[model samples]
Target: MPLRPSRDVFITCAVTGAGDTTGRSDKVPVTPEEIAAAAIEAAKAGAAIAHIHVRDPETGKPSRDLGLYREVVRLVAASGVDVVLNLTAGAGGDLVLGSPEAPLPPDPAGTDMAGAEERLAHVAELRPEICTLDCGTMNFGEGDYVMTNTPAMLKAMAARIRELGVRPEIEIFDTGHLVLAKWLKDQGLIEDPVMVQLCMGIPWGAPDDVATLSALVQNLPDDWIFSAFSIGRNQLPYAALALAAGGNIRVGLEDNIWLAKGVLATNGDLVRRAVQIAEGVGSRVLSPAEVRAKLKLERRW
Candidate 1:
């Protein structure tokens, strides 16, 4: 891909991530209602898609509770927001090793492993417009915790997600994950207009650098749709890079909590800033309906 800058770009706001950022930012939405409100706020601020991950109301920890997801979806629908809903199917694959030497039984407190069906329980019932499919397993971050997404596990999840008539946004954490995504497409697990999220700047994942992002963008299939993002301070800068690289952008508290140096940001603030960045560079911000048509997504109201 030879610097094919996208004149028209869409924004995906990751309302709340499954990270331990609640303690760091007061704007991180924990409850289902709060998460839904955040999504709505982002939508109103010009985000075409709302990437969501629910958290436990009381503990402020990431959760896979179906009821919580349902409430969030219900609230978003009732609000009549036009943003496309993208629920996370990346949970339920956590594994924390007991110790460096004693790594037999994983730590029970953090391990939440489950089969394909169980991991996507909420998607089956709620049937959002889009859901994520993590393409590979990785040592997610510091410590013994690993985000496990084996080949067999990914295949199973992809097949099920396809059967549900939901679009799976293949998450590319590393270069090899792109290979798995291609393999999934070859296996007929992923269909047309294959969507991917180029996750960058995590501890163990792909680096957030110009060369790295360019390499990943070049490797993407010609017709595939993609959105790129980098976490933390590099996030806002990556939004512009993504647009210039012929890709869409992702932002929100999920990736970064700061709007500026020492300034905390809400979901709405982040989306507004992304819109400014997009428009300032002569790229038009796409709406939810435009994204739906571009991706050929089915609106499940």
Candidate 2:
């Protein structure tokens, strides 16, 4: 069968990821209310899905607290927006090693690894339409830090997510990660019509270039549905590129912050601009219901 023409492009706004970005910008939502409001705004501005992550309310640090996630979900559910909720199952895997001298001890200030069940506590309870599963591990920038997601852990999490009746949006940072994702699908750990997110331009992972993007796209399974996005200035351009290459798109503060140089951006603004770009390129934006139908996503609980 010939590839389907990219007409109904869906945009997912990553409202606020579990990162230290809260401290850097006042625009980053910290509390559950703020996060939920931001997600609503993004949905109103044309995002079909809202990718969410909660934080410590007091310190504004990334957190895996299930209560925080629950509150955010409740608020969004009450807001009456029709956006699909995609909770982050990508936390609790940070392995910040100690000084080279004391690597065995694992610095308390840095390390935050947890068991599989503990990591996915929120996903099990909240049961969003979708939850991300980082397919593999990689050195995630400066500071000798590693985003640890071993194959064993991935299989375990994938099984749990499937049991919860939540679709796993497999996050692939590199070609090798995609390989592992394919392996998991082959082993029946993941389901058919697999959804993937091509995370590009992170430190020490896939480069943000056409060659790399094309290679990743070419390697995907025939029936899989996927989306792609790049960080910073590459965000808008990559939207067009991804759609033209037969995929969906993602945008928001989790990946990029500025609407323009020296200008801060809100999640809604970022999403709106992406919508404009998609429309300009002869593609129609998909609503939440449309996206749910397109990706076979379950409705919110």
Candidate 3:
């Protein structure tokens, strides 16, 4: 298939993910107001979409509290920022095992498993334009924790999201995940013009090398709309590579922190830098409206 010429590309800033990184950086937003403000800042900095994940207000830890999500969404909606809201439905699935000898039992400190409905409560109520659906189960990292996404769970979530008229941003961490995503499509769980995010550079998943990225890209269905990004130092560079590979780009504090070798990054800084990179490659950055049209997303209240 012939590659599409560079046109306006959309940039999604994953503002704050459900990770335990709040202690690592004070810039990470904990309160709903802060998350909304950070998202607004990112929108002003040229982010077409803001992928959000709420944190616990008191402990600064990841939480699946629906009220917190509601507050964040309300604040963002009231902020008057022209950015697409992409809430995460990928939390509450971490399953950390005790040890190699006792893998049947889960580790208390790491396990945070919940039912699919419970996991997606925020997305269901908020009705964001886009929500992530992790494609399959995988070892999250060297730690005992495993990112659990059973076939049944994925199907249930996808069906519910479709019913709510929310687009599911299929999160593909490896080639196998893409296979599962395709299967979901074949099973009529996912709708036409499916959106996917090629997550790279995480441990126990596909490495952040050209060969791996190219292979993953090649394996994707011709009609699938996809974007790609790597974590840490390679985040900006991956923006260029993803565009060159005929895909979109994603970047933000959720994936990386350093603006440079030693400089800590704000979400806006990362977004502004990504915009510069995309424009440098002769591709105009898409606005929130453009992204909505391209992705066939429905804006919610």
Candidate 4:
């Protein structure tokens, strides 16, 4: 893709990620009500979209509970906010190996594998405006845990999401992931104007660096709309970087928990700050309506 300057930017606030960070930060929304409230707060504070991942409220751990997802969607809808919903279909693919010495049983406590249909049950039922499709398998995080999303699984999930009239945000963790995403698009599994998110600074995926970002950006289809984000401290800087690279931005507690050193941040605060960065860089922050029009998103609610 030829790099062009951008004057308009849309921010997607990833409300709560499926990570083990609930105990690390008091600001991370845990319950359905809390998550919905945070997402609404972000939208009100200038987030074009809210990227959500439901958790087991009591356990504060990642969950695939269909009921939890339903409630979150209900609460967000009841708020009457205009935030575009981007629910995650990336859960239930965790695989923690037993051990290098043993390597069996798959550690039931750490492994949470599910069928493709089961992983997307909530998305199918709720029919959010946008849902994510993790485009490839990778060794996510540290240790023996692998994030498993096979070709067949992604194909099925992408087809189902299209049938539900929801846009699938293809998540690219590395260059290979982007290639796979393009292949999916070529196979007609994904619609035109493919929306992608470049997940940077992941432990085992792409690193948070300029050369890597440039490589990924250059490989992307010119006509596709893309966003770039990094985890932790890199998240804030990526707001400017993504725009400069002719893409959108994503930020929230899912990628970072701090506004600064020793200071916690909220979803609204992150959105507000991201808006500042984009505007400061001479880019107009786009509203939800603008984002929908640009992405050709179908809002059912």
Q: Candidate 2, residues 1-301: lDDT per residue as tens digits?
A: 1234478799999988876787667999999999999999999999999999888889888889889999999999998888999999888898888867877777678678998999899998888999999999999878768899999999899999989888899999988999999899988988867999999998889998988988998889879999999988898888888888788989998888889989989999999998998899789999999888877887865
2 or 4, greater by TM-score? 4
How displaced is residue 227 in candidate 4, in Å?
Answer: 0.4
Taking the tens digit of each residue's C-alpha lDDT, what string does model 1 give over 1-301? 3677889999999999998899999899999899999999999999999999999999999999999999999999999888899999999999999999999699999999999999999999999999999999989777999999999999999999999999999999999999999999999999999999999998799999989998999999899999999999999999999998999999999889999999999999999999999999999999888999999997876
At residue 47, give the lDDT of candidate 3.
Answer: 91
Candidate maximizing TM-score: 1
* lDDT score, candidate 3, position 273: 93
When 1 and 2 are scored with TM-score, the better candidate is: 1
Best first by lDDT, ranked: 1, 4, 2, 3
Instruction: Give the per-residue lDDT digits (tens) of candidate 3, residues 56-166.
Output: 899887888899889988998887778899988888888999999888779877788888888888887888999999998999767788999999899888888888888
Off by over 4 Å in 3: 1-5
- What lDDT tens digits, residue by residue, belong to model 4 across residues 10-84? 999999998888889989999999999999999999999999998888998988888998899899888899999
Q: Which candidate wins on lDDT? A: 1
Badly placed stretches (over 4 Å) of model 4 are 1-3
- Count of clashing residue pairs in every prediction: 0, 0, 0, 0
TM-score of each: 0.99, 0.97, 0.96, 0.98
Q: Which segments of candidate 1 are over 4 A away from where they belong?
A: none
TM-score winner between 3 and 4, please give it.
Answer: 4
Return the lDDT, model 2, position 62: 87
